[model samples]
Target: MKDQGLSYRLTAGLEGYLDPADALVTALAHGGGADNERCLKRVTAHLKADVKEVSAFLGLVRIRELPRREDIELRNTAFLHELGPSLTGAEITGLYTELVRRTREAMQGRLGPRWAEQLAVHDLPTKLLRKRIGPSTVADLQQRLLRPDHVLLTDVSQRLSGVETALVRKLRRGAATDDVIQEAQMVRAHADIHRMKQQSLGTWPADPAIEADLDERLLLVARRTIRSHATDPRPANAIFDGLQTTLETSAATHDRWPLYARDSVLLMGRACAISDECRFDWGTAHESPA
Candidate 1:
């Protein structure tokens, strides 16, 4: 069974490598004439190099596979210690930066206009750099990002929904005060509305009227939630004050709301958790809830 599992994994990995490899080879063949001996030699060299790298990577994987299950931390520590003498942090960072640059170049070369459209849609280059993914994986990822299917959209939507639902449930059950719950809900609503606006950007002929309505509704929720919790003496009231200040100071169309809303939610959540912890600690230490 273990051997079969390994076989399946190896086959899947090869399949991933093969598709891109085939496309690249075909591109080279088409770009260079079929009768070009130089192109043929280049293709042969490329394949051989790829095979050698894959074999070496697999060998390392197999060597690490058993020890990984036994004591991953110890194995990782030993591996890092071995590299400590030779591999400086600056070297690692330089290598990573070069990888990202090469990946960007490859995407720009292959994807062209589609790649530009993606950049206009989001800060994709920054995201790629942040992820620090390998150049070899970029082709597959670029295809998916450029042409996301219904399944991908549905999966992402479901995952986001799942996360929001879990957070709401926890906030309701765990919050020590109604004020905390209300403030958290306000932040959550803002985040949801911001996400909806971002999603609308992908749609052609987006209805500005509908978006305006959402914006108004979000503002109303924020104002109402803040008003209700204004007199509350909790530490989370500071979060509400910040939100109120932002609402008053910022222009209605400013792009700062999304980030502000996200930060507010996180801050409020942390404040609530700390407040609950403090109450618990006070109760336990002094036999009275603060």
Candidate 2:
């Protein structure tokens, strides 16, 4: 079931990237208005092709089917092949390295120091390893291994969300032709870790510690968004709506921690109030707060 869930999340993550990619491409193709639209169409087609290649690579990783290296020269050839023209060689290497680093970090966080050994024994390609480890041991190992994958999958999904958010922000800003073209070229570069950190906090894990953490993160994100977009009600409201939905969903799952839920709801209310005041000020004065 966990494997199935991972597969589903992987697909969802790819879809998350694709949906925004499509919107971005469409926006870019039309961003130049009718005069330059013909030229922009070629750019959009190239970006679409790039997205397809990246999607193929991500799909392979999703299924755990990435080809093993044959030699030092051929190392990461598959990744390079799939990401060509979209990313420089160094960028592709860095991206792969970041993925590996995140996977390791996830394992360490979930499995402690000896995660490599723990994962390796369970993932051994032979039935002999499992037989020797015994049924109970195998089951225990499998359960423990599931958590790292869950953490990794969640991280991937959150990064996709960040990309989508960035694209939406660009769209809301009435992205110029150059901005749209640059954005399309740098689609994978939009996964801001700082932004993702706040968004990632809303994931499930309904303990007191997690609840408190979520509350803090949500407030920080809301305050920052409100401050940055004080005069721009559209972007501020979009952010507020996303955060509100996240907080509400989180609050709903706090049957075991009603106080936490109450506090989160109150925090959200405070944010909304601040947003309302800012919007009112903007509307009345047509000026930003000093």
Report the number of the highest-TM-score candidate. Answer: 1
Candidate 2: residue pairs that collide = none
lDDT (Cα, tens digit) per residue for candidate 2, span 1-290: 54676533232122112123444433333332222345335544756756444443333332122222332223332223232324455555665565455445544434446646766675653333322334454353334334432433343334443433322323333222444324332432232222223344664354658545544554566555445554553443345445556666655443233433344445454333333222111111123357
The window of 10 residues in a row where model 2 has the poorest summed lDDT is 276-285
Q: What is the lDDT of candidate 2?
A: 0.39
Clashes of each: 0, 0
Q: lDDT tens digits, residues 63-143, model 1?
A: 111221223332332222222324454543454455457656655544445665765665566544443446555554334
lDDT over C-alpha atoms for residue 124 of model 2? 53
Residue ranges of candidate 1 with Cα displaced over 4 Å: 1-176, 200-233, 251-290
